[model samples]
Target: MNVEIPYFARHQLSPGGTWISSRQKSLRTFKLADIGEGITECEIIRWAVKEQSAVQSFDPLCEVQSDKASVEITSPYDGVIKQFLVGEGEVAKVGQGLCLIEVAEDDTTHVESTETTGQSPVKTPVQVTHDVAEDTPTEAPPSVNVPLRKHPLDPTNDLSGTATTDHVLATPSVRHFARQHGVDLAAIAPGSGRDGRVEKKDVEAFISKVPVPDEVETASRQQEDVVVDLGRTRHGMWKAMVQSLEIPQFGYSTSLDLTRIHGLLPTLNAHIPAHFLPSASTPSSPRISHMVNPSALYPVPQPPSVPESGRFTKMTYLPFLLKTLAISMMEWPLFRASITPAPAQDTNKPTLTIRPTADLTLALSTPTGLYTPTIPSAQSFSLHALASRVTHLAYLGRQVPCGLTVKDMPRRGGTISVSNVGAIGKGEGASPVLVPGGGVAIVAIGRAKWVWDVSDEFYRPNDDGMEGERRLKIDVSWSVDHRVVEGAELAAFVETWRGWVENPERLIAVAT
Candidate 1:
């Protein structure tokens, strides 16, 4: 069945939710909620529904681009999509309405509330209405009722139970989000929103200062484990990274003489220009701030021999590689699919084959675990467009927005991934593990070095025909989904990438 997903709407929904109390009717619009723990707003990039299309409650309704990721906004209530208040690339603040949906009237309704003090009100009893499913395991209410703000000294009170457990069972990213929100792990209660999942809302009401109920910790030997939280971007990456590990892994890499990228640097600099080479310490700048200032703080001068390629293009090589990957993935749709929901009817369990209109949810790691700021489509995105996205996300990683709602990455669609370790000098073989939900591939780019080849190689200039040749040796590792991508095709993919670097113009065709 073809479902119509309109990018925009010509009308708003009539306020009739009050009348649909007894029907399986559609209701008013519901905006995108807090999907990540630290995310404050997101740009609506695509709509999965139009003004009048029936949608399943959990069906992907819209794709949202947060500072952390580009994820589909699932319908919180099942109904017909009645209207759209936001459009593609339009930034919507947290809790802003994005669309309306009419739902089947049921005994259940969303109960919103908040705590009374400098603590979370997470344990406020919520009527659980959802059951665990592969797509949405821990379902929540339509909207969380945020308590009207209160003060510690305010004479307001509720008998809301306090959070008692310090170590809650949640993904590392969720744990971090709880901390970022000032959710005290010691207060409130743990209710697995799905299959007993203590979801984001449960954590929101939890606080570290809540008194321990009945001294449960003193009764058990508590092993010490420092919890690290993976935020939305990291959670997404964790899901994808795991998918890549279960497959047969392979890697093929070759340095693009870099001669052309190096060559193009001079011209590109004359037209645009760059500040410096990017590194771990590079400060991502607008993306990551807090670094020394070039004018006042550093008191440094541009190196006289700084080549434009090294100064500008060199800064963007890996991202271009990602663009190169996006082109390949578009040509090979199998790479972006998840393999869990196989067709039992087929001889070979058919993995889910997807052709994403956008592949911008790629993530990188940080101290907090993993994070990704949405990058635009790789195929037609300009270098500036790509660079700007990378820079912004890199900084957001450091900024760590508070009060953002985050959930554990459910095992699902992971197109592909890259892990770069080449900046220091030499490549090292890495066993990047699979993140526990879903994902099929991860590429680890190792160090770089020059090798000497002694022979009258016809591939070189005549002046160096009989001399020892210096060629850069680069290591590339590919982690694949054994469920779908096989070793041979995986090798071919890497080989094709290798060939592109071997001949830089090959990249231009894709770049243009």
Candidate 2:
């Protein structure tokens, strides 16, 4: 019953003399490369290469999203994509094989000796329980109509019945079966199946055991359950937050009298450099004319080094606050110090590394996640220069696509972090967390609210009875690691900060 087959068809066969194609073709697994510093994993945003499609070296294969930004991965060899190990919308660890590429004998530059010697590496097929089929036809090309299986961790994955607080491990078929019978998968207990994956039989058995509910009863049963898997950035935040729980922290709260600083803002804003201002300026803007007349407000000195572009034009309390914070840290050296465990050579005692300059981390909240961009050597920059840098960093953080990169968050981030909680709302105080690697001390700046002062009694005689004037004051809450800093030193440190905050003119002197 042997029938003569065509030469092309014979070459495609898996057995007999047709093994030449198999011998010449080699499968190489391409692993994910390190896209950014400190990034452990990334989510596959999209696949550029299709299964069995020919691709040249350096061609874009896929796009992966890291905490910093979305990056494209390219091919290293001239080959055809065999299969994707980690599907789109799924998280893949750094250094894990992303996909298998089938390379021709002549094209594989440095393929393993085993692969080139007619012996192919054995690969076990990954078990796919999802609705989407993993296998693609070897002969047929990829089709646009083919629907991809929605990843279990995908945020947009639809929920049919009551959304489960926990992830339901049922297969697509089981889920479909449950849906048809109006069965809620979340109510069923985990089955005795492998990895506790709920089988179709498990769903059926559960449905059979439960009594049927009326339409009214089903309608009245509110489904309040929701399930959301944390993205890479958010997950990292969670881990960092959990690590902070191990540190012994203490809090100190005080108010910053912004009476003088507030009055100085109008003058500082007028002196902002033209280079930092927006391109479309207001025709009658007084700020523009005052740029040339910098002598009026004590010329806003240019920074030692300015970024290619500065985003801040108008000065605010933040730039002043940052300036003073940096100055205070410089005066009190301990505030600029971080305690580290003993080096490997000397395991008996711990070590303290005190930075010469004050590196400040500004806690900025973004849509993606919380980022603390470091302003290295904040004391080195003038008030105007520091304001520009802070504005630039904030601009990067607030970009629609998030322009913040790994360089923005230096590895040796400051020994202190500042969270301007007051800028957002009327919060009186906040107990900010001292992130493990972030710093030893963190401060939360609350909104400046007008408060009546009664200190006039001390200055004036008891008989002179004069009502105290209203002063705009802000609350500054401090959280410090108890292991490194003592209460008295922290209080004394706060007193020094208070002195600078109360008299912000000292900041200009210090900066000069």
Candidate 3:
């Protein structure tokens, strides 16, 4: 009768009858795990570990960038990297193998074995053995067995016989630079970057080496087109512009006499509150005279300290123009109204939501993009306060990534929007476009210029015997949703605003 000895028992019963233990090496395919939030795939931006590199558990393996954010992938087990399944710039889907790692596994556990006997096979406890080698085929875990799709950016997946820019190894910014210069990245062979990766310097070198005829260069420059993805703010503008097509708009252009405000600006700037002035230039507070009765003095209360962000030492004509516009909007409620969608039951009759206060939106151009921040209840704010708010908005617009938030731009936007295009250009007028929900009206204020007032109403003999007086004037173009605002009403509204603008004293009388 022969009895089969268990593999574990045989190994344990050595020449000295002592137990022995061993660890086996196994190949594991490290897969890209789900990095939360409905993210299905991400592009491998950089690899921290290279092929054949040793790594420990929790060590960073690679960094991946998704549509939302960049995340770093880490090793799950202590192992030596065998091969990379995904290269840099290549996208890997969740559960897809990212790389193969050789890990050591202890095989000292007991397994059940059968021994052949005369009647039936008897079960015996034995050790499980594994024949894993360095070149052994690696099997992905069952959970990561899904078929891998060929990524478009993968070089091996390109079947085109010719090399194209898409197949070149370069970053998105490098590609953009190449595109802008009308240089074909595919033409720049043997790039200077590591692994022949094309770079901005390589593109510049290519351009410098290649010379073309002047006419050809001009023609190529005209033909070159670079595609850019619109930013968040610009994308919003695109959608609004598209919606603008649904509404009928009419434009009205006219001139405003800024002769009075021009003189008033210097006085306003000189009297800017100490709080609004820069710390270096802030004037010392005046002390009360001892001779005056304390009761008669009435202690002139100081205005609230202006935040550093909102401080401004100088005032421009824009604040006064905006304030007067707000006052006019108060008189003409239609200009202060926003169009609201009709009720589900009554789709034909769209309603107008009239806001009691004039919330003004300024079309501010920033480095990031165009932003329209609202100045709520513009009429209620004093001129100085309005100027400070404008300065604060301008400051916010200059920040990187923009500092304006939803609070600065609420869902319920202003009734009318103003764009001071004149600040950057010497344009006389502009036909501003009015988008739905942007407001009932939009106006572009052009650059102001000094001109002789030759009109019969204002013409006067000057000291030099000239028939007209030198006056400062600015051009303003208005575009309104014709569906809600008639041409006559818009003209009348401008006239009402002009009443406060031409006679600047009225603004001070009604100043809050």
TM-score to native of every candidate shown: 0.45, 0.59, 0.59
**lDDT tens readout by residue for model 1, 1-512:** 11121211211111331111112232565756556556688877678778889887457778776655455666655567767888875789987888766555433322122221333222213222222122311223255677643211112323244333323344344656777666654443455554344566677555444566565674553555657655445665656666645455444433443444555555544443334443332433463345645577566666434322223333446655666667776676666665555466875665465747335444555554555333434566655445545554455554433111222121233456556666544645665544423345667776655566554642455474555666655566655656467778877776666555656567655544
Alpha-carbon RMSD of each model: 17.6, 14.6, 13.5
The reply for model 2, stretches above 4 Å from the true place, is 1-224, 282-309, 345-348, 456-466
What is candidate 1's CA lDDT for residue 188?
39
Q: Please report the TM-score between candidate 3 and the true structure.
A: 0.59
TM-score of 2: 0.59
Candidate 3 structure quality by residue, lDDT tens digits, 23-105: 55667887886553456887887899988899987688998865444556677777789889999878899989999888765
Please estimate how well model 2 matches the true structure, expressed as its whole-model Cα lDDT: 0.72
Higher-ranked by lDDT: 2 or 3: 3
Candidate 3 lDDT: 0.77
Best candidate (score: lDDT): 3
Off by over 4 Å in 1: 1-155, 158-257, 273-314, 336-340, 343-348, 356-363, 372-376, 401-414, 434-439, 453-466, 507-512
